[model samples]
Target: MSIERVEIAASPCPNDVFILSGLILNKVLTSFEYSFKFADIETLNELALKKAFPVIKVSFALYPEVYPDYQILSCGSALGFGVGPLLVSRKEIKELNFADFKVGIPGRYTTAYFLFKFFYPKEIQKIFLPYYEIIPALLRGDIDLGVLIHEGRFVYAKYGLFLVQDLGTYWEEKVNAPLPLGGFLVKRDFPEDKKNRILQDLRRSLKYAWAKKDEVYPLLKKYAQEPSQEVIFNHIQTYVNSYTLKLEGEALKGIKVFFETLNFKEDPENFIWENKDGIS
Candidate 1:
């Protein structure tokens, strides 16, 4: 029998590449066959809304729009303490007037954008750009402030950018829990058995990558924005955690609070897929 091919999509960030490297390279053993596609989180978010792929990585902020069609997998999540996006400026700026300053956001649907909106609450001029483009735009004076996510969080200081605020820290302090940035989403119509199987495979892939970090480093480096191995490892170390293996306790609570903060009425628990075979 021919192996069934399942389409998968995720960003090329170091952490994502590190976690999914095993699956991408067939290092993890799984009966299921997966085809991988790479894109920025924003484009993936748009594709996810159309159910373009059965499995995809998406920002937690985009969850509400795709919740009806997608159920979040327990594994492959990007959540942890001190792992939030940063709002940066080229130089030290004393006053932050929304009307006077223009902010560049990676994507409107990203958690970075959501956190900015949640905290600022004011209608500011936001220029949407790809994650990698934000820093360049800021450096060129295209925008007054930029919301930096992914690898940008690690290297902003090198660019002489001053950190105005750490959105992740604000979230943790306010919610008293770690922030859930993004996670894996599968179509709601996908078979539960297959979904559970895929979930287990994903957990196995994460384990494989962590155990064989050196082996996967090249693959991670291949897709990394920053060439430094230290930065790549730091990115992986920051985002991949126990929550990536399973969503429980404070991680689940944090997600609930985030949804509630956005005025989402549906029960957050209903959106998480519970693996009955003890995969979660």
Candidate 2:
């Protein structure tokens, strides 16, 4: 059968660590029975979730767990980068005093939000909004603190937002591995054979990119909205790491600990390479 185009949606975060790899996956897998398309999910997790699943068919995810109707292909790598969510306060709200502030989250039910809750249950009073709005809302004083993701992770400091905590770093300290930032996932109905082929290609792409950082940087520059090649390259380098697809040992342990804290109650301490059998 002539392969149909496979669509992929990736988060807009510079630290995404998976999008370019997916793009490269497309490049490497061209000889296989597949063509590819990729999209950015802006900064809204819920919006991404709503538009992504079933329709996207296969999408990149930073947070673990899909709608239970989804199947995880493989975690690209243990992105050694985890800058824990910052609790950037507006104006004079110097330190995080949970009772006094309403933190803004990407979404109420997101894993990142739950991470906030699990670590700082006292901050349960925090507000949730579409990921994009949190920063502006914080600037407007509508929200006291913003729990940002994506590019916000890098540039929040420029917005005069103080990093109260680097959650990813915190996670690493707590669990001793790269925080489970994100990876590729597909709907249950995706053909198992195709999914496995795509999964292998994703890993291959990272290997290919790592060998040619100079080449990968151009790809990053191509997609990056930033004008300065130097700036964009630096940003991409800061988050992308050697652990992009190999989420085993410490990385898996880190993710397990993360879920445990959220009461997710399971320790998938190793990246299960195969998407479970009979996954429909």
Candidate 3:
């Protein structure tokens, strides 16, 4: 019988590429029904919960509600795990008082978007956009504040923008949890033996990526959509954690608090996905 295949839905950016690119470039294909698919952070979420990719699904994990559905792994860095949604304003605005401010978060459905809902519930105005447009809108004064993701985190400072809020800091002080950032994940439905093998392969892939960081940058240049090497490199460095380890406790705590504070409530038991080893 022909071997089965697995598809990977990955966020198409340099940093996200760090986790899955080794598998693509080196082609250490896992022993399972496997193939790979790339998707943005948004589309990846929609596809993940449907339990589409049983072997591996490389995507971002923003909300706690997402954890129980998949067995997730580290992305290298922990403190950066909660790099906090940046509050960028094109103007000279120095402070963000949650009282009467309008902040723009991507799509309002994003974990960051809902995060704003929890932290600044008193803010008078809030807007959502496709992320790429938020900075332009801020430049045009279409909005007062832009909560940027993707390459903006790397370039906003260069544009003379000022940050008003560090949501990551807020999360840490509020819950003492390392901010639950994004990382690689494998679906839970995968059979145990195959799942263990994929997990082992992933661990190897992560270690290899870190060991060969210098070689991985150029491979991601096309995906980050950045023409500037500096920007692309920075983005990759900023978002790609080593991915060669497990998530830490502080980060887990923050991840827990993020879910608890959200009004979109979910059962706590499901927050931790169970593995074939009967462990969460």
Candidate 4:
């Protein structure tokens, strides 16, 4: 019997690398052969739009547009309180003059961009750059303000940047829930059995990482943009919480609120994949 091949794509962020490390390293056992691709979140979003990979990580803000073609997997999400993207500037500004400053966004399809637009919906001079490039561009004066995500969130202060806004905090205060940043999505047309298998193995992969942090740390560092042990440790701790293990209760509620705020008409339940036997 020929073992099937599965194509997976995700960001190189610590949380994602930590969670998928087991699968990538063959630490977790699965029947299918898995191939992995690592890229920035925005790039993953664009690839997801083209349905390039069978399983991919994507910004939750882009979910509505990719619906029907892809549905969310219950495991492996970067959703939590205090984990939202940060708006950073070179100098302190008491109040934002949207039209006066050129703002840098990670990507148009990113949840960071969505939250930024949701809270500060003004026509501003917006420049889209890779998430990793936003901070450097800000310091170089290429952009007036930049929204920082992933490991950028933890290291922006070291770059002498001022926090203009904590978009996650804003969303939390307004929605009263954790901010849904991104999650794993599987193609809707994929076989149900294979989907469930992938979901099961993904959960196992996460658990494997948690149980063997020392073993997984190297893998996280291998792919992380900011590989400092402190930053990598904090990244995993912040983004990979109870929600990463399973998306329910507050997690589900947060996503619902986000969709409602965006005026998305699709019910999240219809797109979230749940095991048929009611097993997580």
Candidate 5:
């Protein structure tokens, strides 16, 4: 029998690398051969728009627009309390006047961008940059404020940046749900059995990482933008949780509310893949 090949794309953040390391390292057993691509979340989002990969990670904000082509896997989601993007600035301003200042956004389609726009909808000047560049741009005074995500949340203060808001906390307090950030999406046309296999392999991969943190730390550090072990540890602990293992309960609820907030009319449930073995 010929082994099938699968191409998957996700970010290089610690949480993502930590979760997928098992599969990437061939520690998790699966029926199909897998190849991985690492890219910034925004780049992955754009690639998804172009249908460039069979499986990819994307911001939840972009899911609705791509619903016709992909179905979200229950596992490998980055959503939880206290894990939203951070709004940071070089200096603390008493009053936020959106029209007067320019802000750096990671990408137009990122959940960070969506939350920023949803809360501060105004005629604000916005510049889109890669997540890594947002902090440096702010420090250089190229932008007045920046919405920081991934490991940026952990290290922005070290750069002397002031926290304008924890968008995750804000979303939790106002919407009363954990903020949905990103998730793995499989092509809707992929075989159902293959999707289930992928989900199972992913769950095993996550569990494997958790069980062998010392073993996986090197892998996490390998791809992480922030090299500090402390920041990488915190990043994985913050984003990968029960939600990463399976999207259910509050995680599922949070996703629903997020789509509703975007005025997505389709039932969110319809877009989530239901594993045939009833595991997810």
Candidate 6:
């Protein structure tokens, strides 16, 4: 029989590499075949805007822009307490004027960018760079402050950068819930049967990885940005959690608040993939 296929795009960060490892390494069983296109989150967001892949990972901030083309999947999200982007600077910040300095952001469409804007709200001059390059650029004095995401969260201090603020902590203080970062999205036009299969495949893949973590460790190492096994383990343990298993309760509520704040076109109920009973 001919193989069924689906194209997917995601970031190459450890958390993503870890969660998708089972599927990428063929350690999980699925009837459908998947082809992957790995890139930075911003790049994935840009391509998703063009409807470039059937399934893609995107910042929750980009959901409004891509809503007409994609619906969010419940599984495989990067959402948790104290797990938001960080604002780091070469020098310590004290009584500083944010607008006076240029801030580096991962992408304008990223939840990191949105969270920064939510806190600062000033039209600060911003520089956008790939997630990995932010530290190097900061060291070279290319930008005053950079929003660090992915494995960047694990290694910023070793570069002699000072944390100006934990964006996740600020968000939790304001919203009283875990911050929603990003998740997998499938094309809204996919046939219902295919959608079910895709969700099932995703759940199974995550289950396999969690069950057989040692087996997936090598795969994680193969794709990790940083070579340190400790870093890879930290990245996976921080981002992948109960929220990743299924979006419900606080996770779902946080998403709703975000969409409402943005005044997005689609309601949370309509935007999420749903079943005959309700949101699955």
Global fold similarity of model 5 (TM-score): 0.97
TM-score per model over all chains: 0.97, 0.74, 0.79, 0.97, 0.97, 0.95
Mind giving the per-residue lDDT tens digits that candidate 1 earns over 153-219? 9999998899998999988898898898999998889888988988888888899998999999989
Tens digit of per-residue lDDT, candidate 2, span 90-156: 7655555668677888766454565566457673466767666788898888877777765566666
Which is the better candidate, 3 or 4, if ranked by lDDT? Answer: 4
**Could you tell me how far off, in angstroms, the CA of residue 166 lies in candidate 2 after the best superposition?**
2.0
> How far does residue 103 in candidate 4 sit from its true spot (Å)?
1.0
Q: Provide the clashing-pair count of each candidate structure.
A: 0, 13, 17, 0, 0, 0
How much does candidate 1 score in TM-score? 0.97
Residues 181-265, model 5: lDDT tens digits:
9999999998889888888888888898999998998888888888999999989889999888888899888999999998886
The lDDT per prediction is: 0.89, 0.55, 0.60, 0.90, 0.90, 0.86
Local accuracy of candidate 3 as per-residue lDDT tens digits, 1-280: 9866656666666665766666767645555544567665666656666666553333233444455666564333223554667777777764556555567777644656755665676646777676677788887888878887777776788777877777667766777566655555666555666556665556555666777877777777767756587887766566555323455455555545655665435543343332346322
Find the 10 residues in a row with the least total lDDT in model 6.
Answer: 271-280
Report the poorest 10 consecutive residues by lDDT, candidate 5: 271-280
The residue ranges of model 6 lying beyond 4 angstroms of the native Cα positions read 274-280
Residue 178 in candidate 1, Cα distance off native in Å:
1.4
Better of 3 and 4 by TM-score: 4
Q: After superposition on all CA atoms, what RMSD does each candidate show versus the true structure? A: 1.2, 4.8, 4.0, 1.1, 1.1, 1.8
**What's the true lDDT of residue 245 in model 6?**
80
Q: Count clashing pairs, candidate 1.
A: 0
